[model samples]
Target: MINKHVERANRVITVLFYLGSTLLFILLILSGSINHFPINKFYWLSANTSNIPGAPYDISRWTFWGLCAEKNDKNVCSNYLSPAYPISPKDNFDTTTNLPPSFVSNRSTYFYLTRFDFVFFWLGLIFTGVNTILYIFTFCSYSFTKVVWFLQILASVFTISAVCMQTAAVAMAKNAFKNYGDDVSIGPALMGISWAILFLTICLFFMTGGTFIKKGYKHHQNYVEMSKYKEDALKYQQYMNSTKPINTDNASNPTDPYSLPSTYDEGYQQQNAEKQQQQQPVDIIQKSAGVIQQNPKSSVKFFHFKKTKKIPHNDDGSV
Candidate 1:
């Protein structure tokens, strides 16, 4: 049986992880760090040296929207166009160009920021969206847990890849500003927030990945046990088939020494009776012979008496 509380906790954690990642991607995309100067100090420096008439006093505080705002009759500098590439403003000011005047553009910085914004950010966003949908489906359908787990692992891989790309972008952006003036710092609050969120999301993905691995192991163990049981059942069936009952005709054969007849046939009974009858006369003759042997003296005396009687009759006649 599944542990309901553990399942619920996992679901909750996964949902939060996906949701947070999605929001972070949206924020990163909208923050406009890629189009503007990556560092606040550089932006401030560039804004101070610019020739725009009505630009904000503290351009460092301006967001992407404020920086991208169009020119209006009320303010001349309020409409400064966003640059096509990353630039740190120097002495030169050109109002006609789209780029902010008096700034040095760095091609390497532009490449990294562009990739981070267009590639890694979108990839993370797409992965997070798909993960959220899969999580919801998994939560609703408990039978497809294995499928859900596999898909989640894929999603986590994509998310981690995106995060790596973003980290590289941040590193490149920092490297681009390393040789700039003393007061210029590359650390931006938005970047810090983005990094923190990405770190948290990565941690959550690892946790979810571990959970899926454990669950997969358990599923494999159960499958192995079930297979073993099936094999045992098949072996028992074979044993029973091999040891079936002995043939009745073979067991009851009269020639078999182990055979025991339950009933005697008529022929067999008659044969026994005739044998007993033939033995009776031989038994009577043997008994008579034994009696004669035992009384031989008595038989001789009777014969002598008969002879004496006969001689007496003859002598009377002579006298």
Candidate 2:
């Protein structure tokens, strides 16, 4: 079951990485100060009197509209409402708005800025720092068991915590800007879609980081087990090499007895007995041949076999 989950994690991380790349690209194009999206209406205040320009933010950062705007400030760089009318150049409230205001531009974005944008940014930064430290220590050269696990646990904590806080930061920043001036800005409507993509990207990063830690942890466990096995095997090898007796009969015998283990000593003796039985047959043949050679006609009684007759069974007086 753990193996299946591990595979699933791999697939999820791959898919999410691609998704995150797309979101990052979009975010980059949206967060810049260029004219991709009207980030600040004040920058375009000279464009037209009747025509209300869009927020300075792009579709990715539409949530930032009116974030810096005041209740009655028309010159506010991020104001999302129209100026009051009879639309005086002096008044801040909109009276006859021709177009909606804007706050963010669609030119460039930065991940580092998100950490500074919300209440949880500081916390996230701290966790990210811890995660980075663990990542570095994990590559240490010494072989201390469980240090790797410790690093992994640390990494897991930071990875999960940082991602969660980042998620919260994104949400809180959006909500704060949305509630500005007691009204939802036009920017969020246009750029709010990008938030979902950004969230997906963040989710991918966190999952991948956590998966990496698990892989390392499992690998560390395997190493520890293997190391123990090797130590035991080495001990057994040393005992065999040192305590085993040397073979003295190897030079006299055709085969080496020391090669046989101590438990096989009885079997070795039986094998020697069988060898003696086989030699007896050869000795009898040799002695008979020698006697024949000593005398050309040796008086030896050679016996011949004859068939014995059996009486047949007869009944009564018949034969």
Candidate 3:
């Protein structure tokens, strides 16, 4: 049986792990390393010196949107190829439009990082889902403890990888912007939250390591107890055998203690009879001696009578 406290602790950790993964998933989807286009006009300047003021745009993997300054002293905004954008698309940019070197560099870096980030994100999600299913199995079914532990470790590894990938993506984006001498901002506030959650998840996963240790300790204790009990039982059995009375009779019959053959019984009876005969003479001698001691007067009277009879006979012969 698992200790209740350990079980409860593991449950809490599993819940936290699940929550952290979910929050990180959401943050990864909603927040990107690049928040918006830089505001400065010079940042958008290309090699050509014609100086046609270029638009400021947010470029993402899915779409591009920008605010353009027109000659009429008005601002025009258009979201191109973006279904989620609130505004309608303006005239598409001509193929001849010059693209900024910094924008091109940032775009290349963003796409490269995002591709790997996407891979890690999906891997983390799949592992998290599997871990959740395992948790449910552990709660409802009779799953092996080691199996659950293995699954938890796998989930943790996946989560850590995903967190690392996303962090690297953000770092790469910032580094790219810095290399170009452009001011950059990492945004949505959710990125920090996601990182914090990932840290918490990792901590909880490490904490669950204790559960495995505790279980192994308990198993060792039980094994020791069982071995000690067996030794004690064997000692008790040996002691009982040593103290048990040994029956000398060769008879195999267990129902009767005096189940001897007729010949053996006759021999035993003859031995008893000879012993009584030998003691009879000794008993008779002892009885006679005791009677003489008790009748001392009678013994002396008999001796005197014998002496008188002899003297009378001698006197008659003399007369």
Candidate 4:
């Protein structure tokens, strides 16, 4: 069975981690939406698109919104869009002129990859939020613990899928841009945060799973204790049932203590035999004493006393 103190401590730590992971996930979701201070710094891809015809900007950075480029020596981003937002350059520019051959040919790939990445990320965040709320209540009830465990599993899966998709989308885009002889790189902050979320989700999953194992072990221990108690109770009951009152109905032998149970144990029988042996010597001694009292001469011999001479008093008178 798991130690209560350890389990409680583990649960507190797990809840704290869940809260932290959810907070980070929310920040990631809000990155492109807010586009200010720290949020704007988190993007998926940054590349130089100046060589491509019909491209509006020389340097383009893609975020959850549309794109960001330098304006007035400061980064300016497009308006925010809904989740599962595609990242197709050809579609965005409304032209196929001078776009990278990979971007044009694999338009559907980029569209689905980026779209699925956002969709899963949003789903994961929602599930993780619910998980965080429910985790606190796990200490209150076993039912809550079970529910939270299940939710943790779901959240972990969603978060892992989202992270995997994000990595794939970002890496593929980076490679494509590099192949086109353009300078391109993935945003370190976004990818790093995404991976961190994944790691935390996995840790939470294992922690939740451990709860079930601990519960199972505790149940087994209870069962063992109950079985032992029942066995001891049964033995005591049998002992009580085995003992029967002496047949006092027959007044012939009312003082017999050994008659209560005819099935006397070996130890009791042995003690009784010893007592009879001890009394035998006492009986012989008593009988001998009675015989010695009946005969005075035998009593003197028995006690080893010497007889006195009758000549002593006569000699004293004559002298």
Q: Which candidate wins on lDDT?
A: 4
Each prediction's TM-score versus the true structure: 0.51, 0.37, 0.47, 0.68
lDDT score, residue 234, model 2? 90
Task: Give one digit per residue, the lDDT tens place, for model 2 in 1-319.
Answer: 9988877766555455444444433342233222333333221112122233332322212222222232232223333432111112112222324332221221012223332332232333333334334433433432321343344344334434434543443444344335433232333422333344345435545554555666668788999999999997897788677765745334235566554444435776678567667776887899889888998577475875799997776777455
CA lDDT of 303 in candidate 4? 52
Off by over 4 Å in 3: 1-10, 26-113, 136-144, 181-183, 235-319
- Weakest lDDT window of 10 consecutive positions for candidate 4: 245-254
Prediction 4 TM-score vs. true: 0.68
lDDT-superior candidate, 2 or 3: 3
Order the numbered candidates by TM-score, best leading: 4, 1, 3, 2
Which residue pairs collide in model 3, if any?
none
Best-fitting candidate, scored by TM-score: 4
For model 3, the run of ten residues with the poorest summed lDDT: 39-48
Ranking by lDDT: 4, 1, 3, 2
Candidate achieving higher TM-score, 1 or 2: 1
Between prediction 1 and prediction 2, the one with superior lDDT is 1
Model 4: lDDT to the true structure? 0.76
Residues 1-319 of candidate 4: C-alpha lDDT, one tens digit per residue: 5677887789789988899899889878876676477777877888887876766789877776567775543346765245566667776666776677887888988888788878788888988899889878776666777888788888888889878877887887888888878898888887888899999999988988898667657767999999999997898679768766544323224366435344456796577667667777887899999898898575644355689966544655873
